[model samples]
Target: MAITKDTFKHVDYLWDDEKAKALGDDQVALLLYRSNILGADLRITNYGGGNTSCKTIEKDPLTKEDTEIMWIKGSGGDIGTLKRSGLAGLYMDKLLALKNVYRGLEFEDEMVALFNHCIYDLDSKAPSIDTPLHAVLPFKHIDHLHPDAAIAIAAAKDGEKITNELFEGQIAWVPWQRPGFDLALQLDKALKANPGIRGIMLGGHGLFTWGDTAYECYINSLEVIDKASQYLEDNYGKDRPVFGGQKVASLPEDERREQASIIAPHLRGLASSYNRMVGHFSDDERVLEFINSNDLEKLAPLGTSCPDHFLRTKIRPLVLEIAPDTDLSDMTEVKAYLEKEFEDYRQYYTKYYEDHKRDNSPGIRDSNPVVILWPGVGMFSYAKNKQTARVASEFYTNAINVMKGAEAVSSYVSLPLQEAFDIEYWLLEEAKLQRMPKEQPLSRKVAFVTGGAGGIGKAIADKLAQEGACVFITDINKDNLDTALATYGKDTGSGALMDVTKMEDIEKALKAACLKFGGVDIIVNCAGLAISKPIAQTTEKDWDILQSVLVKGQFAVSKVAVAILRAQDKGGDIVNIASKNALVSGPNNVGYGTAKAAQVHMSRLLAAELGPDKIRVNVVNPDAVIEGSKIWEGEWAKGRAKAYGITVEELPAFYAKRTIMNEIISVDDIANGVFAFVGGHLSKSTGNILNVDGGVAAAFVR
Candidate 1:
């Protein structure tokens, strides 16, 4: 669709005259409206990729005098979700004076300090790097963005000529220059020379449009973008390739999951620095088409489609030579192949950086690849956190689309290497990168919680997430799993239906976790069952049910998880939720007690076997944790209460008073003990049992 004055009319403008008056600041309201409009359309601007500003009058904090202020989108804030706080207010007079100070400023750091000092409100967020351009542009409102359509024209070889023709005399052109005081001055000079120009297109970068009001500025941006879109449609519509191509057969879902389960951990190990990296897979049709293309080798490595993307994804992605049918089971071979590829990529990137390094160039970033294109399989994005991985995935996906569009229209070209280095090293961009909160202790760590729908398992998953771990929770009951996921938030915790009694279901869940969060670093075997009855009354079916869920199920899940953890070669934790019944069986609890006993023994044995591989296995034996515990609700609570000679309502107090400490064991209490084991709080202790029984003498193993 061609952008017109009414192109975005369908979008809900959150701010109208009534709301603007209610807000008491029409400029800020209009700025919010314009930012949301631009941000709403990915074709106009993607996440964290655009800035908007307005000139208004506000009372100065220091002088208490009305002064002209420039309110612009703050650093690191997404425009679509921009709030009043997201826009920093600066004294226009003080900001415009930075042009004089720019004459002496040699370092970007000094300019940043100067910009920070110009804030009209000290409590406001830092202003955008393009503050100078916005301040000098003379318009009451301004919008700057890296719209895909505009980028297609800007990054082309004949971009200047095409842009001139498309906009006629309505727009001016700025040659490629790193955004700074100098670029701002150049833009001001160009606009002054051409008094009638409505916008400016920066070669190899983005577009800028402005007007007297927010609506006019927004409409001008749309109109410019629409022209570019129309040009591409007219010229390249026939040449653009269809979405589907050679019907490359895909592996069965089961087989693909198995393969991803194995390969993801290996990739995680190869990409890890001091901390393990997480992986995110994309089977997006665009990604698949790019990877499966005959020209992938030629097209994939030719730098990012836009310079702004360099900050998130670097210049290019690394393409691994693995296919869907490749054997990822041989960890040693896979590791070696990946290490070699990484080394080669490092050498090539280092040489490229050195060749293009300028006096002001940012130094080289880590050699690790952010986006990895695996032939025959979908692409993967790696990062120290899931959010970063998702961001890289998005930018790379956009880069692929832009390149494909450019190739279809004409030849695909990118900004010069030197320009990319400028952006990568640009102090403003670098500061934005550094401003992200420090990685938490378990920032990139992934944890899997079986039986996580409720009870102690749910608590354990919540604790893991609190410590910065991405948690994948599973339960046989899909409804319970859904509820737990909703409470924890789908972003922080994902869920899958898993019946521990079924080995195939166990494998499928493990693979799903691996594919979802790259790999698992910690596994909590919390799935269990209880069948309380006298040995004579307990049928064979009851014994099998308890044994299959508590004993055999734990064994199956642990075995598969340990294989992945070993491939990761990273030290991992396994915390099995045993029970106090294992140490001291209650009356008629033969099956449940025996199953819990087997779990404790299995944990100890696995600890011994996996110790050499740095995998720690430990057990948290919780007793009478009746509060918020699904295990102790309904019939189980009634049965246990009957055994204790008390009503169901009094069962918790009865169990609490039975212990010497007279403390009620809670799910959080058990979760805390498990945390001590999994968080490496007891790093040196393994094959050990932690008791959360509130001083139950009968449960004391030592």
Candidate 2:
């Protein structure tokens, strides 16, 4: 495979002179472009799995002298979307000096002190662990990535041989070494021995390439990777062994998603610690193809293709065998199986840690499995937050690709379990963990908000997410749901189109919430309907619509949610968004008032019934919350304003003056009342009513 201009044509270099100049600094601009290009391809770098650096000369403001500085990717930032702040500036001389004086210091202590003391900019974040490797390299631009094509070769039994054959002495090969001072020194030695080497392959780790310019470094990486890809294609692209014996043929899409929904909550519960776990299910062609393969049990448990993945996905994924005809409704059996599986996993992990952990290494990570492989369905990745779960999902997806590719050409292999353990408990990773914020009040709680696409429901969902609860929202309007998800962010909240009156819709939404997040810890029934009419003028259709949603809808959602909570053997919360009209009926508001009154009473009855299970039921009766309220907009607001002898624009002021506090209620005020109950602040107070009506004397509840 000769290197040509079109050899790496698949990559987009994004080379516009005007656009590049606008980025302020030419080197910074080129580095950003190169990082994005490399990260754009998942085969190159998955999520935050790679780093890049550039060495440049800058004049120090204080010293009034030219200084050589190294700009490397900082911790906790994704390479695909890296910006100026994502790269930390370090004085190159100070970074390289640590190698001589730090011979006896612990790796963690030396690295931390070096990073803290050596600075080109005091405000910039700490540089990546690979900064030293970059510092010692003799190139101006450097890129280190775990591309799948290259990893296929590096993780093979004859990886060094294959690398030599492909690169023909153009690149040096370094055997697997836990990345730190030692690995940096080893790489420096390799480069020094082979002065003409353009790149280096770290067996079972990744690939590194360098050049005097960003384009040269990036293209060299691509060319080297292309060679490896070509080698696999020529050797194994044809007559590959097809792993047979799939337990069951793929199910219909709806059934697959339903199965995913049913199993998600159980997995989440198993994965949760202090923070409830969120799950991301993927049945992408690659994932499904891998899961459905006959060699799944053989390949998945072998280990992750790269050591970096051990941090996100442990060495092995938990594989659960679910028959095609298994009953998902009977969670009793499923729950039992998961609990036993988790116990066994815990014992195994403890023993594994005991066997491999170094004296000063951090304690074993949470024993819960991050990746779960379900036969006949797909895979589920669990983490405390959605972003981490999504990243794990991507890692598994890439792992499948790399492993399959490796097996196609030769046998697939990974680093030894000891090596994986070393990386998993590395002090560099521990430092990153220390920087995360403390868990929030509702960190482990999951909340479902009905009518969450609009004013009050959206507000409640957003607030719950802000407090660290993984929120699942439902609304009848698909457009509104999409818009709300777009605004609130898909990671914080997921939207489901649901008509609460329909039993199937209600069940499906609940299942989705369970699957996406774990079982619900909090339920806020914000879905409601209003019709103002005298008792005689209230048509059956009008009355039933309000009754079905405001009364029946709350009952249906709560029934399913409570069952999930009970199954988890955890106490839960249920807050109904009732109305002040439930206490003080306005003129010609018979239907709305009657239904809301029934809802309030029903909540009290549920409280009494569920109290033994530690499920608290309460009502927040908010009146005249017109601002940003879909319920109070348009015809409803106009009619209510007319009832008050005022125009629509004056309705809020009119209601405000009517209340003792002269304050118009807002959606956030109503949300706060709901949180007060669901957040366990009102733990002992159930079957109670909280008012956000600004002291409506007639509607006051003692």
- Name the best candidate (by TM-score): 2
**Candidate 2 C-alpha lDDT tens digits along 567-629:** 666678999999999999698788899999999999999999999998999999999988889
**Weakest 10 consecutive residues of candidate 1 by summed lDDT:** 8-17
Model 1 scores a TM of 0.92
What residue pairs are clashing in model 1? none
lDDT of 1 by residue, 154-194 (tens): 77777787778888867788888777777888889989988
After the best TM-score superposition of candidate 2, give how far the Cα of residue 28 lies from its true spot, in angstroms: 1.7
Off by over 4 Å in 1: 1-25, 237-262, 327-335, 352-365, 427-434
Worst 10 residues of 2 by lDDT: 7-16
Model 1 lDDT at residue 140: 94
For model 2, the superposed segments whose C-alpha errors exceed 4 Å read: 1-18, 104-109, 236-248, 273-275, 683-685
Specify the highest-lDDT model's number.
Answer: 2
